[model samples]
Target: MASNVHSLSARRTAGKSAAMMPPSPPPENLELDGLDRLLGAIYEGPMESPPWQNASQLLRERLGAAHVTLMLRPPSQDGSGAMINTGPTQQQHVDSYESHFFAADPFVRLPEGEVFSAEELIGPQWLQSQYYREFLQPVGVRHLLGADIYTREGIECRLRVTRGPEALPFDAGDKSLLRRVLPHFKRAIQLHARLDFLECERALFAGTVNRMLLGMISFDQNGQLLETNQEARRILAERDGIWLSGNNLCIDSSQESRDFQRMLRQALSGGTHPRAGSEPELVEAIAVSRPSGRAKLGILVRAIPLGPWSESKQRPAVAVFLRDPEANAAQPSQELVRRLFGLTRMEAQLALLLTEGLTLDEAAEKMNVRRNTARTHLRSIFCKTGVTRQTMLVRLLLNSVLSLG
Candidate 1:
């Protein structure tokens, strides 16, 4: 695994001595509505960009603390980790903790799933420690309440809340409240990690499909378009053979339209049907004729698979993949092409045009160059690409990952 350390330094105010203060009285009774809202925020934390910002704020308010910091990933010497702090502390204070003070602080590695205070964990000796004088005291962090959660997903997260000397120290009531919500908090972190992984995979596959010059369109059970990629939108906007009529997929030819609708219905049925003891759904294909006399658009219709326990929702039931044989294949930038094959600008441009299905004479005319110049560039492209024929050169360029750039 790679390190997550980043330059997270920021500016903050000067520190003050943390006077030994008596523990404050226990807090008021926890309200049912407040608990409900806090639980909701905890689950929603994973979806937040900074993860758990709302939950951290709510927890801070509930505890009446100066700051609430959730160390989703602990800070390291290299200054890499995921930490969220909810407080009015200066950026420098945060920078100090993330960059350097984190290592010296003795509040970490708490008893798993148990909440503890600075006094309970470190005793009276904590006040004389270097961490208190140089780091916590300077920022007015006098009292600390912390809990550690180790999930099955291999995440060791710490929740810490601090109070200034002016405020009362944490009490039994505060620890009780934290203990009550700790289980929910652990589950939320697990849910977030799982979702984060799934989202990354989804983006990777989506980008690969788009780079392949394939148009993907997904439809709901009602035949309404649910989602589409950039290539699909581009193909529909051209309106050569297939396009959208309102929100419905359409073909220029009546016969093809009927065929497409039938296939779409079959695909939808396959997706929603019971999966147990069912035969695999057959993928359907069709060629949509163009009015402009261009090559027919190749379309493949298939069902989006569903798990046995899938719920009823407005989701993609059928998917359509469109391939335009006459359309230009996605090409890398001229500079990229030049670097990949060690070809000059002119040679790279000529190679790109050839990949678009243009003949040497047509490409030369487009580039405002003579046919003989185009031929010379072509010969050079073949030699640089280690191919002997024009078709081989085109095939090589199309098969390469250059288009993914």
Candidate 2:
């Protein structure tokens, strides 16, 4: 597994003195909100971009440190690990630390989860060693205080809060604040584990019916919702005229609502359509209007045909396909365009706009670039994408499955 350490640094801070003064009091109110934020991080959105980073940042401020980093020590592959740090460290510094310097650093070679002062982890002698001069001195980090936080999946992650040379060493008060917030991190890890499982399941189910640019809703024999794709979820969440009230699917108009329920019931019961003898399975398409007076949602409802002996318990009796005319299309993978076609980021953006039916002038105006620059980007895009005419460029992009965004 490739380690993707997103902008995390391994920065250490100031020297320790035996008679160090106590740090300022921990912010109780902010820490309470920070704990809440950490719990909500797992459920906020994609697990790929959880709010744990933000929570860690909050901890940094609360603990009165220059920067905070959460690092996976002895990386999951049982090697030197990755870091997720908050600070103004360069990517070069991060790469240098993980690839070379981290292995020699004595701070990471300590006991886990127990708060340790830098003095405890590495004595003054080691701090002045060659590793310190070559690495830490240049980075301007003098010392760090750390504690290992446990995840439900048993991933080994340690939190390191750094201070600069001028700043005093982290005191007991800082350690106490970290201890208070530790339980929140422990619970957040469990939530992360559960979300991982759920997201995997959602991907599997959505892949079945929503591979195309369509939203799907699976309903049971009693018109109860069994499941829905992410797109269907967005439509339901909007409550724009059509929404789900309890388990029942509902539309705006009372007359249309009655018709929708009747059609849904018929489809769910596996009964013949009104024109069953001729059409057998006529797809029932409806225009669901929005209460906001926006464009109507186009929904197509149809019955799932199965043999009398079929024993699929999880199968849906009725499926609804929803499409909002105004909904944004799935963005294509800009990475793919850059890698495959060698278009620069700006050129790729212009290419995407061109595909979206935007004229050169319009694309320029939207990009906030002059028309000449836009034309220059367009020319580069044409060369890279292997197309000349705007029509051909649109055709290539429309047919290709590069839009992973």
Question: How many clashing pairs per prediction, in order?
Answer: 5, 10
Candidates' TM-scores? 0.72, 0.47
What ranges in model 2 sit over 4 Å off? 1-50, 72-82, 109-112, 129-131, 208-215, 218-405
> TM-score of model 1 relative to the true fold?
0.72
Model 1 lDDT on a 0 to 1 scale: 0.86
- For 181-247, candidate 2 gives per-residue lDDT tens digits of 6666666656666777898887865774454557888886556789878789888899998888887
Error of 2 at 282 (Å): 19
Among all candidates shown, the one with the greatest TM-score: 1
Top-scoring candidate (lDDT) = 1
lDDT tens per residue, model 1, 18-54: 2345545555333777888899999999889899999
* Lowest summed lDDT window (length 10), candidate 2: 6-15
